[model samples]
Target: MSKKGKEKEEETMTFKLETAPFDPRFPNTNQTKYCYQSYIDFHRCRRIRGEKYEPCNYFKKVFTSMCPNAWVEKWNDQIENGTFPGRI
Candidate 1:
């Protein structure tokens, strides 16, 4: 493909794989699942953008703003123990 075509494709390819339900607060359960998914999305973003400071900055901001510290800590532990559900 031409450079211009590739640029247009990249622009259109911007996507958010993780999304909250229509009414996130409606669920009887706590928001643990929401936080966990955002954590996973952060890692996925890093994986796609490479392990660099700049590329993953947006995701870092997103998860940090949305997910709590305790949940993120637990998820990190699970990841270290090789038991996290997501591939990343």
Candidate 2:
């Protein structure tokens, strides 16, 4: 449990994020693609900016706008566990 707790706070700087508007281009109205892409972008941003979360703030808004808190939390866990399906 203690180990898990520390992992929860773990941070990595190995990705990038795009400031341009996110566009999935699919006809589906659901924001799944947008959220996933945002996830990727967020990490990309972190990679460039380092472990500090401030530099990746914009991507946070992009994902939070299209995805629910629960989904984001779950995906974040997947990312730390090396199970995220998206490229980062």
Please provide, for model 1 over 1-88, each residue's C-alpha lDDT reduced to its tens digit, 9 standing for 90 to 100: 9999999999998877654443354365666666556667678877787778485665566567667788778878988898877777
Clashing pairs in model 1, backbone N/Cα/C closer than 3 A: none
Residue pairs with backbone atoms closer than 3 Å in model 2 (clashes): 14-47, 15-44, 15-47, 16-44, 16-45, 17-45
Per-candidate alpha-carbon RMSD to the true structure? 11.7, 13.7
Per-residue accuracy of model 2 over 10-52 as CA lDDT, tens digit each: 6453467544364757347676777777778888989887868
Model 2 local distance difference test score: 0.77
lDDT of 1: 0.70
Residue 58, model 1: Cα distance from true site in angstroms: 1.1
All models: lDDT?
A: 0.70, 0.77
